[model samples]
Target chain A: MQAYLTLVRRELGGYFNSLTGYVIIASVLLLLGFSFTDMLVKLNATPTYVPLTELFYSSYYFWLILLLTAPIITMRTFALEKFSGTYETLMTAPVGDLQVVLAKFTGTLLFYLLTWLPLLGCMVVVRYYTGEATLLEPRTTLTTYLGILLIGGLYMAFGCFASALTRSQIIAAMIGFALGLTLFLLSLRSYMPAPPTDWGAKVFAYIAVGDHMESFVRGIVDTRPVVFYLTVTGFFLFLTLKVVESRRWK
Target chain B: MIVRPIIEVKNLTKRYAGHTAVSNLTFEVGRGEVVGLLGPNGAGKSTTMRILACFLPATSGTARVAGYDVFAEADQVRRRIGYMPENNPLHLDMRVRDYLRFRARLKGLTRRRSRLRTEVVMERCGLKDVDRKIIGHLSKGYRQRVGLADALVHEPELIILDEPTIGLDPHQIRQVRQLIKDLARNHSVLISTHILSEVEMTCSRVLIMQQGRVLAADTTQNLQQIMSDGGQVIAEIAATTEDLRACWEQMAEVEHFNIAPAEGSYQRCALTPRGSFDLRPLVYEQARLRGWPLRELSRSLHSLEDIFVHVTRAQGDGEGEEGR
Candidate 1:
């Protein structure tokens, strides 16, 4: 327990004490601000749509920012440790590799939340600008936040696995970005062909994180997509743990 | 020596890509013992040390560290062992105290206990003056000392140091040797190094290895005795070469004799003692009777360095295989 916390604290510190953390936050916030203005000002000129009054959904801009920042934030977790020789130190410590992986997962989760905080203002302003008192999209808004967390967790897990695969930070980031993009675009399988009947389309839909997240953003929280996102996160984290353990043997 | 060995390696083997890094190596370190894993480059000493630390798994065989099986309960074994690698890996950007605090927590100390241990270790390693300095700015010697301090703060029973003095200056080397000697009061130490004198001065026993094989394991004194070619006695005699040879051969105390130039009227005779014989008294008596002047006399035995080379080379030659 103490060992896990120690790792978590160090990783959290790494995200804040270094320039990489600031860069990710700045880039994500900038994208969020841009997309919110672009979608609100240009796309909808006439006011024919009725607004709900309560909590505004932070979905549209949130997903875009998460997609871009998740890779940059998580790609260096294990890769930098390996590159700087700290991986050997961490391995030889009394802690198990599984605990180290968990700490990284949890620590990056904290960094992701920190990056998302600046965008919450956009949520409040959207509520104010609509001139709807107590306006909210509870079901869609809640599910969208949940989706963002799950998908971000999934990306970090995938990036953690990639980080474990190599010692170069750049290569780790490239592979992580490539893998996340592939997994995010799994739903596009239907556009390419007939999918060999419905089963192939179902399977592709099952694998695509973006398809599941966007579905939640529309106010429908389906159990299958929720389970799929969680399974991907768990499976990738487990693989990361295995890789870390094998490194000691090699 | 203790009633039981602190560490025992039973037929431990580790292979890598069609090459064996350590081959059925066997040795034991007793409690409170300072043993050196002595060998040249790529001698499998580091491989053996890593296995003992529970960082690397063995290909076959069992190693028990602190009475825990390495593979079956590696975490338990790791908790009881502290390892410092050759590279002296640390977060260069982190302050020294912060690093120690973080490492202490990782070693399973509670928050309060970690801070206390951090303070204790900082003082012990003479790092109090630079506690707030980032590790990158420190000198190589200080960094190495910090590395050892990190290993010590955990208070593990066995501390394995790999190439601890690799890049330090002579003064730092001596200081580290003194520190290791001081540390013998509480922990059993296994030092793997290429410096022979470090072994001679700091280690009580040595496990000499070469090419993935254990050549010898014994105390410094015992290894010297075991590897001694034989004892040689130098004596002064006034007799001529043929006369001295004739007289020395008649005595059962002498095995072989050689007459060589000596100081003044005396000649130097090098005699190989026959099976533990003391020929000094007899030689003096013979010189008294002959009225021949005796010059300086001395006895010589093989030094540790000679025995080290002799044993490692002899092991390689005996096996008819190059070092792995």
Candidate 2:
């Protein structure tokens, strides 16, 4: 447990000590701010019944942030360690492979969560300007953040898994972006004009991150998306653990 | 009462995609012993250390560290040993003090213990001056010291250092050797280096490896002794080549002799003695009795380098040209 915490702390420190973490956070904030401004402009031109939380959560900017920031945030976890030759020292230090994978996962997830904190400020700005309390509705805001956490956790795990597959951070980032983009494209199947009927629709709905966020922003707390995200996150983390253990055999 | 060895390996073999790195190697390191692993490149020294450190798995073998099997109880073995790999990889972005503290904590030290050990090792490694400096900014010697400090911070029973002083200056190398000697007072050290004299100066026992096998393993003194027994005796005397050859042939102690012309009318005769005793006195007596002027008569002492070269070259010869 102590080793796990120390490793997690070191992983987090690795990000903050370099320019990678700040650059990621700054780029994300810049993108989010531009998207929020665009959304406000649209809202002013045409008043809609959609709540600010729903409008914000279901925007194209949300998926863009999720897809782009996750790969950047996690590309360094295992890839940089291997590149720098510190992986041998780290793995030989009495810590289990699972602990290392989980620590890195947690650290990246924590940083991913931190990057979205400014989204809350966007909500406050909305509430202050529009004088509407619904933007800050306690239940809706909480569920939206929870949904964001689940989806972000899954994407971060995918990035970490990609990072474990190679020593080059660029290759890791490319693989992570490719994986996340494929999932996003798959989820886009639900948006097709002639979407499949019955079971195919259900399958598309099951994996659609957009649909899951829409449900959460509407103040619904469903267990299916929660379980699905957690299961896939766990699976990716398991794959990373296996990759870390494979170092000894190789 | 019997004390168990800190490290024991039997029939250890590590086969990669095409070649075997370590082949049926066997050795033991007793408690508080400083063992030097001297070998040419690709002799499986690093491979063997990696297996014992639990960083690599052997194909067919059993290695036990501190009474725990390395493959089965790797964490137990890892906790008992501190390993500094080749090149001394470190977090370049971190400060020296922070890196040491982080490593200490990762090695399972408590917060308080981590702080204390970080301070202790920093002082011992002469890293206190650059504690606040980023590791990437430090010189190669200082970076190497940080790596050493990190290995020592955990206070493990055994410390595995691979080429710890490879790139250091002569003064830094001496300091590291002295530090290793000091470490031997409490903890066992397994050090591998291409520097033969460093091993002669520091190690209590030496393991000379070649082609993934132990070519020779013994006390440093004993290894030198084995080489010096048949060591050469060189003498410079004013004598003809034929006379020198005939003289050496008549001496029962001379196994083989070579006579080469020296400055003007002088001949340099090098004789390999059959026995371990010094042949200088006999050569001097022969020269005096023959009324020949003798300038130099000295038994060439074999250093660790000679023994290393001799043993490695002897093994290379035994395996024939195909082994190359």
Candidate 3:
């Protein structure tokens, strides 16, 4: 358990100590800032969600940003280790694959958290401006935060698993994005007339992080979504562990 | 064989695709013996070291490091072995001490213990002064030392260094070689390299492997026996028709000493000796008797390179030239 935290610290330390994390946070904040005064944010300020809502509406935008930024965080996590030939150094250590994977996962998640919080200026500014005028309940706020966290965790795990699959971070990121998209798209059962349609849909939805992410978007917290996030995170993390172990075989 | 083996292996095989990375390999490293794993490229030294370090599992067979099976008891094996790769793999962004401390923690040390271990390893590896420097900012030699410090921060019983002197200047190489030698006083080491002098200086025994098999696993004395068919002794002298019936006989290395065509009165001759021996001092005494000009007296032996090329070529011809 302590090893897990230390690995997390090491991973997080690797990020903050470099420009990748700062770049990611700068971009996220830049986008947020750009949306605030830009003509697009001013035009799209729907009564339902703020102008920032429209900026974040694509989800795919953040997803795309995540897809781009995540590779930088995770590319070096395993691929660079393999390239620089340090994976052997780490693997040969007394640390288990589980601990190794968990550390990387935690490190990336912490990077996400660090970046995610500063961007929450939206919530803070909303509170400052609207006072009680804002209709965001505590539940909705929690759900939104949980939604981002789950998605971030899922991406980190998937990226980590993909990283273990190869020694190239760019290739791993492509593979990770591909996997996340396929899983996300598979939830549309009606779009496909396949025979295992319902089962496929349910399975895809269960694994579809976005499906779980929608619950938080609706500002509704549910046990199913929590369990779904945990299970997918666990499964991907386990796959990362398996992939790391399988390296010796390769 | 005085048998107190700290590490043991049985028919270890690691096959990749149709080609075996390491094929039916078997060897043992005893406690406190600095064993050098000498082999050419594709001879599977790195593969073998990885398996022992618990970084890789063999396709078949088993290895035990510090009495722990490398596959089934990998965590325990890991707990007992420290490893540095041919390349000094490190997170360059992290401070030197932080990397060592993190490694110590990852090795399952508690907070206080991790700090203590990190300090000890950093101090031992001569990294105390640069503990605050980022690893990337340090020179290659310092980086390599930091890598070694990370390897030893946990104080494992065995250290597996894969070509620990790969890409360093001669001075840096010598420094690290001496460091490895110093390390061997307390910890057993399995140093894999093609450099024979590094082995001869730091190792008590050499394991010359080729084409995924052990070609020779013996002490320097034994390897010299095989590599040198019969040693050649060079004798410099300033006399012709040297009386060598009884004088050269005392030097066991002087198998057949003959006077070459002497320039002036100086006798220049060489002795084709039997079985690894040095006849320089005896030749010096022989020169003094005849008042010979003794300038250069030396014996020639095959270096690790010569030994590797010879043994590997021999093994490869039989194995159909592995990996093309």
Model 2 error, position B170 (Å): 2.7
Better of 1 and 3 by DockQ: 3
| Local accuracy of candidate 3 as per-residue lDDT tens digits, A55-147 | 343444555556566655666678767877778777777677888888888888888777767556665575566554334456666667777
Question: Candidate 3: which stretches are off by over 4 Å?
Answer: A38-73, A183-215, A222-228, A248-250, B1-3, B225-229, B233-262, B265-324
Clashes of each: 8, 0, 3
* Candidate 2 C-alpha lDDT tens digits along A1-250: 9989999999888889999999989998998898798879878898776667788865678888998889999999999999998998998898999899999999999989999999899888888888877557888889989988999999999999999999999999999999999988888888866545678877887898778888988889899999999999999998988898886777
| Best candidate, DockQ | 2
Model 1: how far residue A17 lies from native, Å? 3.6
Q: What is the lDDT of residue A100 in candidate 1?
A: 88
Better of 2 and 3 by lDDT: 2
Q: List the candidate 1 regions with Cα displacement exceeding 4 Å.
A: A36-68, A123-142, A190-197, A247-250, B1-3, B227-297, B321-324
lDDT ranking from best candidate downward: 2, 1, 3
Best-performing candidate as measured by TM-score = 2
What is the docking quality class of candidate 1?
medium
lDDT score at residue A224, model 3, on the 0-100 scale: 74
RMSD for each model, in Å, please?
A: 4.2, 1.9, 5.0
* Decoy 3 TM-score against native: 0.83
Regarding lDDT, does 1 or 2 come out ahead? Answer: 2
